[model samples]
Target chain A: MKDRGLPARISCGPEGSNMQYGFVTIYWRDMIRFVRFKTLLISSLLQPALWLAFFGIAMASNFDAMMAGMPVPAGIHSVGYLTFMAAGIIAMTTLFTSLFGGIVILFDKNWGLMREILASPVGRNHIIVGIALSGVTKSFIQALIIMGFGVLIGAAFFAGYAPLQIVIGILGILAFVALFALGFLFLSAAIAISMESPEGLQGVMTLLTMPIFFASNALYPIDSFPEILRVISLYNPMTMLINGIRYFAIGPDFYALGHHYAFTQMDIALSFLGLVVFSVIMFVLAWWRFRKAVVT
Target chain B: MVQPGPAGDDPIILVENLEHTYGNFKAVDGISFAVKRGEIFSFLGPNGAGKSTAINILITLLTIQKGRAVVAGYDVATEPQRVRESIGIVFQDITLDRDMTVWEQLEFHGRLYDMPVKDRRDRIEELLKLVQLEAKRNELTKRLSGGMKRRLEIARGLMTRPTVLFLDEPTIGLDPQTRMRMWEYIKGVNREGTTIFLTTHYMDEADQLSDRISIIDHGKIIISGTSGELKNTLGRDLIHLETDNNEKAITLLEHLPSVREITVRDTLIVLMVNEDGTRVLPGIIDTLRDAGIEISSINLKKPSMDDVFVFYTGKDIRDEGQGPARPHFLRAGGK
Candidate 1:
């Protein structure tokens, strides 16, 4: 054979820090998939808007008529039912989008595509971080769409705020959305990696979404919930996220559905902290699952 | 013949007593071998022969159950990152994402290996040209034909210019012409000084492509040598004789010193001769004639890889009963 000399050596240093940004690669590939499936992309973006249009309008009209004669306490901003549940819609959209985002991992695993990444030099944590970032990005886009649509459809968000406060409110809402999205995406990834089939993952997700979506304050007020459910909602990450969204979107105190809604600064901070702790715990769970994952 | 690299005879991959088990079933049972730095080496085996299991361990996909393995000068168990960085892989099945374009697939691989932007772009261009997929760069992977997908996978495997490229059944499910063309691409890659570790069940693939062949069966290496050396172990020539009385012919030729071994397949008696067939044919004909056995057909030829494989493994590829052979081993402890 001809002397072709040695193969070209890789350019990375011995420390392999150049590969440290490998999560960016994973994120890029995922985004490509996210956009490439035009049907999936458009449907995911449109689903939340549809929920606001049909479900939000339908429920708001009935609930508003029922609460029209309720006495509003002095010095309290009395908003319509649409305004109340709009924040819930944003929370709901973020929840659903982020929870299903990691289904890509299950699909990749089943199709043998994950073997390429699993055998690469990229750390396992990078895979989790990458999926989490992309899931968060998807949630951000969906949340923004729902916010814009909700406002156009007469949900009284940013009703009396200055431009500066509005910007801060939007940022605060996104902060909560990011944390909540990260938490569910990490949980989804953990389950997806451990599952052997997509059907199993779909079943688990269905089982999870039932309690997570309904047991919290997304659809209506959770104050009337039974004692057991009230305790569960108190600690629910979904409730924590909605609390933050409402505190930022609406005023600190408001009246809706004949119920007085008040959020203290300490309450908002604690809600944010709840999401932080949830996402951290989910991240650790995902990291442990990825470390134990063996794909061949 | 591939010449030794500047590293002299230092092996690029070294494994000692490598064993892997799935629960109580042993997939790879105490196999040991080494691959040189700049040669194509093959593990020639049948289905369920622990080929994929061993490749997965070497690629660091599966945890090392026992023994030690070092790939590209890095311990697979301890320094898997270094090992991963130093090698590339083309899996047995088509692992390409159906939705990804050809360009994106290669680009993704380059990024996975942390290749610089400029280098990734330039290499993508070069590999697209090399694999003749430049025209299909923007086409989705699912749109490409089977051969094109395999070629694209090969290009992706070379994205980082890995020191050792591991291919498991690279040309599986391809047409005859495509299989030949795939072999050419593999040889061209090897000629560029990247040591290739290939596992294939195709006898011709191992014979024509690999610099060394190791016949593995039941999770063990039966033999290892160059193609010529392997074929020579079955003797120089093979003679096929169909006599009117096959039992009498076998008795007559069994005592001939030239005949090394004899096996019967239905009515044909196949003789493996140490001496050249041309000289041994006359003595065999006379012996059969003296035994009052009429010869219906007689043929003489040198041993092919098929003969060598069947001789060593004792399993006929054309037989339908080969499927049960593996499960039978699982029941009997694979002794």
Candidate 2:
């Protein structure tokens, strides 16, 4: 090591003055990492588009013929399956992306970077909230990409709505997506903290995400399921979230296919409020688990 | 640079009855010590002797469950932010972000502490130069060698220019040359008025560097003093005498004022001497001859730090197999 006669002191003006500095530093660190990897950005955008291309079209092709034999429900029709699946896929993308967002924290824990951050002068709340905010931003951006791709493929279901209604719809979708993303981000963080190794976390992610995705109404209407599964889907938060997205973005009349429940304003509000409460609970749980894990 | 007072007045770090537990086991059992400003103090122990746990508590990484720890004038439990601001820590485990460049890692740490942009740049440049890592500033940290990564960690720890620095096993797996170079950098940093709290199992490193040393074992401090003082706890010199008749030599030399203890093994009579074993060698030779015992060869050996460790802990620090309590996720000795 050579001596370059660098200044000895590093000025850190006051104790509480730079509290926000920790938040900005953490947020920028995640964003810079996100931007630096072109492959990550490309891959994230590509997965949902492929799901829309393969799954959306495959289901749409069979729906008209399939509905000809069976009666169309009161609020849904066979022709609108493509539009319905598009909205559902957007919710699924937000759900999956946010669920895995805490992989960053898992890496930090294993590599000891989390310990470094925990030992710093920064407030613990800032660390958790900063990561959650970044997850929300990433999910929101990806949701927009899905919408753009859907319109590019000539779905144009959103084209029918007025500009103001579109703005209102996007706000509702953003609110629902943000809450949903935060809930899963906290869930992932909670699991990552208790986990000793990344392999354990990986197993949990695989086991949980599939059941969470399939059991909900992201791919099908809850009423179409068997009795037991119908009860499970009715209470599954993801089902409520998908229902909220359909009401706001796709309009109330096109809410579900062969569904038993009516799409009322009360239902939409309750779904949105349910997610908010879930997010807060998970956030508190994650913060508590984080404190216990880092100490040991 | 504040000039600290004598050893007992206002230590930079003060701990009293600190305790920590893991389930039913007490990892740190009510330990207390003080470190003066600008002094290099070390806690020497084997792998699971609670050195890292105590350090974790002092640096505010772990909350103290049953005692008080004050670092740089703030209580570790109540004023963790203040404690964190006053100290910098280099963990025993590697904590660098592999994807980041060396410069980027330092910049991020500086930003976390809220340094002004130009000051952060200047400090990073100086630190890179200090660690001799200027050329590797733009290279990803994962590409650096084990030694280089250790140096980068040190540079990052110093980015905030903390009042006190805690280094946990700073030279655990480095090559000899790198270890020596790191010592030079550490001494240089200390000379510039930073109080250093170091922990390591390397006896010679502690012996060579620390002004005060504390030997901890089984969650309790067995002994604490300077290296010389600890060595003196055993006799100052060891005398090995090869004789034709060992029993007679032991009988004749057991009463000598200079000798502390005498034991016979095979054809050799080993004597623990207090001081000037060489000056008393002729007297012993004459006495052995008068007693009709032939002295073949005589040798005097000064005690090393290993002997000091053995004197206090009853086992060599490096020789004891690691305990089951310290479970490393990554393999040890892999850097």
Candidate 3:
């Protein structure tokens, strides 16, 4: 018979840890499942690419003529509408992927696998981090795939920046993606835990996210909006994220997407800092909710 | 062979008047018990008898409400992670990730327990072989049959090589052959050193497998002992007799030395005998025959856990589910 005691060579760390191995284990499981679900990859990638192709092209000419008459911000030349919307599409893809992350937890709860995890020696905080990290990773990769589509379609904004700048921009996009994703993931997880069944959460998420999507500057220039919507979009976190990407990826002059165009050094720093704070707060709230939840 | 900690030493699991409530409903009332190291101890009860709730508290899954529970030398509430590290559970509900393969499932569990990479691979292979699922290693869990899923759950529970394994109705719906095989696997595991605490309503399973059993009813442990002890408490044999003259037969049999207590049903007379039922069956028949009573039929039945349950609870465990609690004395009258 084989040795039945604790495996002789097994050791994951110096001692049994609180979260490291468990976090990575949960993360790896999510990644494995993420890779296996080819349909998910295809659909997530497809929708953003279609948005870039259809809406970017269909509306570009009209936007181009309209934009020529407007004052161009300092430090940048005129730009095509396609490039402006490419970043928005990237943000949208990130939102969509991250927003649905809690569906996996819902499935786990429905399938009773959450109890298996709950009963494990892993820390509850680690479970939250593992799941959140996995969701952020998925959202980042999905956003990058859409960005790849933007590159293939020859969005002039991408070609305008140096290769190093583009890579840095992708990293910047990931930060924004992580923030947006974490916020939505937290909201989704909270609703999932409190709601009786998953059937209503999806409808609720769509209703919740659609307002956030349309109320911001994602699909259109915030400057063109009515006074009240302009105020809403001005303060909307999505607008801040898109604005941060606009300036960080292309240049500060590309902040022309919004009514409040010029961003000082502090403006850029504070925007991302706000995202960091929001992400952290969302994480803390989500963890608290998760700990309080009873998985029948 | 790996040996367990000495028998009758410190208990591997201990509970002291543990209580839990779902709002006002007492799911697990104040019940206390201890399981010896390396013993197959079972909590026997019908549906909703608080078996799962108790197991959940012990496994560190559910929060303990009133009293204390210690598993593997750690308080369940205070050191839940330590308790969790020392235990594994096969839940009554199937908790498999249906999208994943059996290998992936075991690997995930091994990783959670922080097993090293090489050791994890080896253990996964061994476990898959043990469960006879090596051939289906790549098959997704959802594609597996119910029996296969249960086997995988058992294998996953062992992936961590836990010291205490909690099996909550492990063989609830398996076929007889599968159940026997499951028992063999469980016995083999226990022999190798793990202390097993299981909960099941199957009397035969408790009778055949457990070193001791606690019969739980309505959140309280009514009685607990070895199978033989429990059966012996209910007396040796229950003799059922059918006769044309029920009143005359009851009058005549009431005075017999072997028969301790006689309870009359609508048409059948049940006698709790003080001796081996078969030993005194012929003598009782002869005495009754001399009394000119025509005996229609007679049967000598050994006391089972079912009888023990009825004897202790004063009601059928199955009947308790249908309505509110009846008066204790009414049930004690044994209708």
Candidate 4:
């Protein structure tokens, strides 16, 4: 037979031990899928703005009227309800986007695409880390869109701040958003790897989002809740994320909904720390699941 | 055609007493074999006969539950990363992402193996031509025909110039014409010096494509040899006879020196003959006629792979409307 100039076999020597960026490959493929699905791309970007436009406007008008006659502390800054919930909207969009980010993993597993990845030389942890990175990217995009659109529709985000402070505030919100998105994406990946079907994963996501979105202070204040729910909301990572968002977007001290909103530096720091801790735990969980997973 | 490696060279793949179980069911039960370098080896068996499970274990997709597997000189359990690096796989099912274009599918595989950009690009061009997929490079994988998808997978498997390629049922679900074309591509690949380990249920596939064949059933290697050697084990020729009285014909032929073995399938009697069937047919006909028995039908032919498979496995591999036709006798002992 003719040689056909086939490449020689790769030697498994020290040269083969060079650092492998397999996760980047995984991330690249995911981004291809993200861009290739036009409907998915448009819907994910538009969903957050629609929520801000319709829900934020209707609720803000009602809450702003009800709090018109309430007393504001002499030195405190009083903001409209639209401004208050704009931050909430950002956090909400991030929550929805991040929670559903790992759905791709489940789809790949079901459609047999995961077998190609698992059988390759890539480390299993790369899959988890790669998915988390892309999830964070999606969340960042959605959060930025909501921020821009929320301001265009009369929500006073970063109002009265110097240009430098606006940049800092945006970065701070993204820092919190990145940490929070990582936490949920890891959790989503863990659940997805363990699940057998897409329907089962969807059911679990619904079960989770209901308690997480409503129980936290995203849509309304959690202070007037019953004693048990108030305590639960205090420890909820969603509440921690919103705390960071409000502290950066709004001022340190603001009043709305007949309640005084004040965040000490220590409170913001602890909330940031809470997100870090949550994400770390979630990473460990996802890593464990990936290590245990077997795909053929 | 690629010649088999010399006897002294180490085999590309080695498995010794390898066993695996899922809960209480042992999927790969104590099977051992080796694939020499520069040759095509096949594991031929029916579905659920542990072919896929064995392939999965060799590819490092499943944890090694028991025994040892060394692929391309790396121990699968202790050095799976090295094994994975040295081998490529075409899984039983289509594993392509529907949205990714044909070019992207190959690109993704190259990147997963950490191929340099220039090499990845050049190899993609070369393989696109090799598989005749250049025109479909920009089309989505889902848009390609089933045969095209299988060819793309084969190209992807060759991206890193792996030492060994594992193909599990490569031409499954394709038309007959496409299957023949796929065989040519596989042979073309083997000629280029990569060892191939394939598993299939099609008898002709194993007989035509493999340099060595191992017939597996119920997670055990029942027999292994070249296709010629396997067919030779059933003797020179096979004689099929349908007589009014099969039991009497069997009784008459059991004592003949040329009749090596007799198998009864329904009313048909299959005789493995030691001499040429043409010479032996006259004696068998006279013997049956000397008695009151009369022959309803008769067929004589050289042993084919189908007959060899039936002789050993005692049943046809295809799952059609017909029920299992287990031969009453003639179970060939394993090597």
TM-score of chain A of 4: 0.93
lDDT digits (tens) for residues B1-335 of candidate 4: 22346868998999999998999999899999989999999999888889999999899888888999999999888777788889989989999998999999999999888899999999999999999999999999999999999999999999999999999999999999999999999999999999999999998999999999999888999889899999989999888899999998999999999999998877779899999999999999999999978999898877877777776776677642243557543222211
Better of 3 and 4 by lDDT: 4
- List TM-scores for all candidates, in order: 0.93, 0.88, 0.90, 0.95
In model 1, the Cα lDDT at residue A186 comes to 96
Most accurate candidate by DockQ: 4
DockQ-based CAPRI category assigned to the predicted complex of candidate 1: acceptable
Worst 10 residues of 1 chain A by lDDT: A1-10
Candidate order by DockQ, decreasing, is: 4, 1, 3, 2
TM-score of chain B of each: 0.92, 0.86, 0.89, 0.95
What stretches of model 4 exceed 4 Å from their correct place?
Answer: A1-16, B1-5, B320-325, B328-335
The fraction of correct interface contacts reproduced by each prediction comes to 0.69, 0.58, 0.63, 0.76
Tens digits of per-residue lDDT for model 3 on B1-335?
Answer: 11234764888888999998888999888999888888999999888889999998888667787899999998877777678788888999899998899999998888887788899999999999988999999999999988889989988998888889999999988999889989998998899899999999887889899999999988999888888988887678888788989899899888988888776545778778889888989988998899999999887788777677766655566567653342121122221
Residues forming the 10-long window of minimal summed lDDT in candidate 1 chain B: B326-335
Tens digits of per-residue lDDT for model 1, B42-125 = 999888889999999999888888999999999888777788888989999888899999999999998888888999999999
Over the stretch A1-296, how does candidate 4's per-residue lDDT look in tens digits? 11111113211222245425767888998899888899999999999899888999999989888888888889888888888888888888888888888998988888847999888877666788888899889899999999999999998889899999999999999999999999999999999999999999999998898888888888788999999999999999999999999999987898877778899999999999999999999988887787778777
lDDT of 2: 0.79
The whole-model lDDT of each prediction reads 0.86, 0.79, 0.78, 0.87
